[model samples]
Target: MASLPEGALMQRAAAGLAYAVIGHLRGRGLGGVYGKRVVLLVGSGDNGGDALYAGAILARRGVQVEAWLLADRAHSGGVAALRAAGGGVVKLSEGYRSLSGSQPSVVVDGIVGIGGKPGLRPDAEEALAMLAGVPVVSVDTPSGVCVDTGEIDGAHVTADLTVTFGSHKPCHLLDPAASACGTVQLVDIGLRLPKPVIESLEAADVADLVPRPAPDGHKYTRGVVGLRVGSATYPGAALLAVSGANTGLAGMVRYVGTASEWVKRHNPEVVGDGQAQAWVVGSGSADGANSALAFARASGVPLVIDADSLRALNGPLGVPAILTPHAGELAALIREDRGDVEARPLHYARLAAKRFDAVVLLKGRRTTIASPDPDTPVRVNTTGTSWLATAGSGDVLGGLIGSLLAAGLAPIDAASAGAWLHGTAATLASAGGPVTASGVAAAIPAVIRSLPAVSS
Candidate 1:
């Protein structure tokens, strides 16, 4: 209230929201919002206030706006503004569909705010279920999502777009809730917000974070990435992992264990078992994953632990390591159900980070990287496509991240950058077609070369 006039912030919010809706309608060939209908699913409190105010703006611009009141009361000032601008307000207890008269261009979900707990009242759920097909634009967040953790315990709005004010909340970046929010547009209302609870690495940010080799750098000086991956049962994993290491991001690549013959034939540049600045272990090492991890830990270098090795972990591993585990492996390590872990990825990723005292790279549609420090914001990687889910992909990611670690990026940076590059490479290689894991690995150099050089 002290920032400006009592309703100034809300007005700013409504203006942004109205513009977004107008743009959306025009993009959909609706000409403009001049005669289009927009239904605001308004409920108790400020969330409703934002929707009501936005509806007023739309009404003033000649849009037909209807407020479907879900509760007995709403933001009084916002309702007054809507009435003043000739917007219609209809109670949910009254006939719901009749007020709309026809299909709406969009549904603005302001039924509940972050303050409300997850799940909806029976009447609100029924009202929403009736408008299931309409595209929704959520204010702040999708109602019913656990704002801090992204958990959806009950009914929630699956928004086509979310116009969040100021900085993004955990819901915008974390999975489940993030997946529910189709696309997010941040609108600054000029509030001095606190530091983010979590962060995501954009493509440009990844380019800056990636290390560039010195002009006069030699092999040994560039830094070596040692790999202890692949087995007789899955030898292609070794090739894929080595391919990731050989992207020329690191100084040299080293291979230890059963797949050396295949490794040398394809990549003769790879050296035999030896010292390295960092070690990548576990992806497809199968039965020998534990032994390899022990050896890597003994090497006393930073490690990228993935796949089979993740399953073998019993404790912290007593090293500076990055734990790369998808839902199944994480579920096994944390002794939770895979379904539960998948649903609450952030919680488990953070729990595993604290428990292992290492960086946890939990892979999913949206990858999340959590550092051991509880205070540090977890980094979410929104890069890559579903095509990146192919077999041997994680192996490549592990080796790629291992190279960054050897090149001396922090564990979080290495994992986050590796994820960004891996995903971007997958996107390029796929080109709207099926892509193999090796293709993804092969595309890495091109992806790196394509990145804009970091600004001085």
Candidate 2:
């Protein structure tokens, strides 16, 4: 901002926001922006300035725009511009009734920005309540959210679409607060940035991270993944895990456990236990989780630990490992409350990763993969549907990660890439309907096939 001409950045932001609002108006089939009602909740921050300027542009394009000033003062230039463009500006006390006849087509939330705190004031809360049920387009971020921590303290705006500038705030990728930001639209305003606080795997990133077979590769040459998962009590776990590993990501999958008979019966391609490039243990090993975990540790190969085996970790394993745990399981491992883990997922995930000296993949609505090194950015996955909450789904994910580990990706890469694939496969299999564990596994090949063909 120091290098650029005064207000140049703001103009760029206003232009992008105006375009986005126009695009949204067109999408709503609201007769092409003319005579449509747009309400702007203007605050004291620059976010309100952006909204006011955007409202000016909308007003010039035949939109009936009104700015509801939520603060004692707002941007003088922005206010003047809106007034010049024939837009109405009123105080928060004027209320929603001030909007000329009929409900507003949309509300632009400029109540707060990146510099604000997490909660709304009583008047802001009252203003939000009055405009409840209206679709909101938040500028920069949905007001009243922790931009850096992704934490929500009290009343905050839940926007239908959030227009962010340059880069995504942590709230755009992290959960709880992320859920409030329905659809994040990033607008580049030509600012160079440093490293991000968090990262997420796109399809191209996953494709690059996932290993592909060499031209001369055979079964062993490609990679072999072994699974010591499931027991007589939970044989289905073995089958599901094998199903995920056998999706052609790895050259072969071998099963070594009490459920070998059932696993072989269901997945005939799975061979009996032998040496493997990587080992996946736990899942539903039940009483045998300890032995399975110890055996995998002794193998000296990378390991993917999940389910009943998570309880076996008393301290850091003296080898490379990816620990898969849900909120409850993670809480047990870290000795924290489940609610606390859920609320501060990034913190807990990194803590567990450092504590165990391994990559920790904490599964949830938004799965987070953290490396033991603090410098490494936490990879957050934003794919999949709520239908993936079905039983045995996590088993399949553990197997997928193990397969990637066997295929020669680093533990962190394998964990994150596997999560991306697992979530994408679940979304593909579900297609907005219910999906079983086997169904998600079955969709893995199709998902891999769908990835853009990148040079190896």
Candidate 3:
């Protein structure tokens, strides 16, 4: 399957792109591409060819098409086809000021495709600078972005909508590049690429991954999540994490720390101490690393390591662990290994996964989940809002993942499901308003119930 031919793939991708651009324009009250002006920024590869062919179709529809050749050499066949269809290449010196006055409704950025290096060439950058104010639709991955790693090196284009081919690439899902790709629409090119290098979790995917309790299942049968968190100094973190875990998603919760009494007071169903199918270590346990490590080592099940527990990852964790780190903590982890997290998140996440021999969940605006195996496609969680970044949100996320692990999902599944559910719950709780950590926890059951039921 990996050996599928490329020529056939490019043709299908180009055709799909044409249809998508036409449909998008039509949807915006521009019926038929009749009087619209489209500028295609052509490069030196099949990507430029895709744009040239797409320009040919638009020209045939009576649309005024102009191809701005950025490369010294352009796609020969594509350029010929565009000229045959009445389109002409304009000199780059026409300056963006002149083009902005034309007010072209849509600009097609075909400057570079997936084969591009980290940043744009000086010439490419100069051309892009001219089109700054115009609305752009990027073909394939956004230009100047690390397609495989999802990093934006030097300068990159911010697209109004990115039309991706086949499956989604890492750049479409991982931040800060994901933020640049405004709205992503996948074009089915019928090319069976190898299993995706990275994947984003959708609502339906989360529904399928979240385990449902059996009708005859008891609390113990549902699987227990042991949480070792909270201290005299920061007791609220433990409370918030436990509050999230008690959303009727887990069979039972067991608290193991000095703040066990505090957790027991809020939710009496929690056991003082017992065996657990999963463990949630690190939260408000600022100085409680020893307790977190002890609990994690003893639990023999999947673990969700977050906040302070992340600092305790020096020793052998033994169980299937998921490390949740924000940019700061992640940067620290990267610093320990002489790497940079912000420069390349995907690379760092993958490295951490292998080094720890566990699943790694890097949290940010876009939460990324990666396993130790490089071939395993990273899962990005997209269903979140800016309000979800409020304080204590990470603790809630840890509890949710711990619940999934207790429900028997594997470490990766648990992390992905938890992130998805956490985002969904935040959306529901927000309802166009601000939401607190407690509100997010209260919204989990509704989010879970809203999921599409699985069919036999």
Per-candidate TM vs. native? 0.96, 0.97, 0.92
lDDT tens digits by residue: candidate 2, 165-254: 999988999888899998899999998898986999899998788788888888898799999999989989988998889888888999
Writing each residue's lDDT as its tens digit, candidate 3 over 151-214 gives 8878888888889988888898888788888788998876557777788777778777878879
1-456, model 1: which lDDT tens digit per residue?
A: 485887788888888888888877887787857888898999898999999999999999999998999988999988999999999888975537574578888999999887989888888789788888998999999988988888889888899999888778888888888988888998888888778868887767888988887899898888899999999999999999999988999999999979899999999899997799999999889899999998999989999999988877877877799999999989999999999998898999999999999999999988989999988889988888888889989888999999999999999899999999999999999998899899999999999988876888
Best by lDDT: 2
Clashing pairs in 2: none
Q: List the residue pairs that clash in candidate 3.
A: none
lDDT order, best first, reads 2, 1, 3
lDDT of 2: 0.91
What would the TM-score be for candidate 2 when compared with the true structure? 0.97
Mark the regions of model 2 whose C-alpha exceeds 4 Å error after superposition. Answer: 1-3, 96-100
- Total clashing residue pairs per candidate? 0, 0, 0
Worst 10-residue stretch by lDDT in candidate 3? Answer: 334-343
- Tell how far residue 317 is off in model 1, in angstroms: 1.9
